[model samples]
Target: MAAGGERAKPAVQSRMENFRKVRTSEEESPLPFSDLPPDVVEMKVKEGSKIRNLMNYAMAQMELKGRRQIVFSGCGRAVTKTITCVEIMKRKLGGLHQVTKVRYKTLLEVWENQDPLPGGPAQNLTVHKNVPSICILLSRDPLDPNETGYQPPEPAAGLQAQPGEAAEDVSGSSSKGLKRPLPPPSEELLTKKLQVQGAGDPRGTGASDHQPDHHQ
Candidate 1:
């Protein structure tokens, strides 16, 4: 038992050391956008577009906040891709401190319904099944409302109608050669005219009636 316990100690210690090294490396060296895979970059671009749309939708609210907090929810590749995008955006914009504040929530702990257990496994969980991933960005500055509500200036009274151009009686014949086309007859009027024409056709009815007496 003593030998077995001693054998396990070194293995555990080695794992702890490796964990520390990984954590330190992650803190010291963040993954750059250029380091991201092509597929990841493509995904980021797609997700970034959605973030832009959301920012546009709540422009006023984002402006009021004075800082942007991005939340990326997804599993594995999705989370990593968005994180790359966020990091790139931060670096391109001159770091997080340049703005009032910048933050992110990607871990399951942040999105879980119940409080996370202490030292719980930190992993990215998928949300919004169809979407697979989502990203949002807030802005410090207020977006311009760009209100164009000004009423158009009313036309000058002189422009309304010149004294020489008095309203013409359109119903009467005009001096101008242009003639307005007359409206077409309605279905009811056309049907009545056809009936009247049929009644006036005496040969159609008279010839047929006179011939019928021969058969009798």
Candidate 2:
């Protein structure tokens, strides 16, 4: 029993030492956050983050708060996802200036052999890799210059005609080149000649009053 215990103690101690070394390396591996613009809103994306959640945050800042610029940043596998979010936002909002930056991030990886052959010491390997990273900048004017610019569906653009405008158009068309029929004449104001000509009255023919000429 004593011999078996002695053999197991060194392996356990070696694993603990390997764990400590790995923790120290990983702690020192990550690079500091890059400098970003103060005026723009910066969003950091990760693999576990959902697109919908990120979009909501972006909309609140850009559309609701009227932010002029926005930036999307991601590294490693998240780089593609970050690009996708930016594209979707651009299509929805429209009229934005876009700029992209590519960078690399270095990650330190640690590999250890916990169980080694008898009489062989445990080993740890540290590898450094550079991962791809991306940053996208989108900017737009605070005011909308184009009437045809895309608008989000959530808030209405007021496409329907206004009451005042409709009234004015109606009045304008009625006043231009539009002739109205005169109102019917009153019985008391009607003239004899006018009444006679109105509907072929017998008095209008005047032949009834013609007298026969005398024989010469």
Candidate 3:
């Protein structure tokens, strides 16, 4: 009886092992490219880019736009840089409204190799990877930031240009004026002048003919 019971236990164990299975489902996340608003100003950030330059550009853009709104976006390793830029801007241009968004992007990889069996077709493998992304929106408008928390920063002059640092002042006057030296007259201008000179004289002796008064 003991031997029979042990054999039956082995059969039950094998059946359980064969029937056991794991089921998993992944949540699909889509990028927010299409959902971005057209009116909002956008700036794309990369990981290896200079933060100081980006901060300057961002500050200038905000000053130029009448809407007083700007957004920064980044993916993968660049996401942290994007946030850092926003923080710098916030501290510099205080009294700004803020909005933030996060999402994941999926990447795919495929590989093909020869099959173990001789003269068989190449086998292919597929893989999927998800990368994170973020977007930060800053504005001075009185409305909500949509899905992102909004905390208005207090007004400050963090980036105010000093006497020697006037280069950062966008709205300030500069010694370098936009007025450039007038270029030499074009051929058309010379032709117009000749025509005027010819028209002014009835004798058809254009301005070039300044007859000399001689004693006859």
RMSD of each: 18.7, 20.0, 18.6
Model 3, position 63: C-alpha lDDT score: 75
35-109: candidate 3 lDDT, tens digit per residue: 445676677787788998888777777776555778888877889999999888877777887767788755455
Global lDDT scores for all candidate models: 0.38, 0.68, 0.66
Query: Using lDDT as the measure, which candidate wins?
Result: 2
**Predicted model with the maximum TM-score:** 3
Pairs that collide in candidate 3 are none
For residue 153, give model 3's deviation from the true position in Å.
2.4
**Residue 138's lDDT in candidate 1:** 21
Q: What is the lDDT of residue 23 in candidate 2?
A: 29
TM-score-superior candidate, 1 or 2: 2
lDDT per residue for candidate 1 within 1-216, as digits (tens), equals 999999999976764443311110011122221222232212223323465543343333324544343332333344554555445554343323211112232322113213333688643333322223333332222322232211222235655465435555432346443543543469668767766766888665444557878888
Model 1 stretches astray by more than 4 angstroms: 1-64, 97-216
The lDDT of model 2 is 0.68
lDDT of 1: 0.38
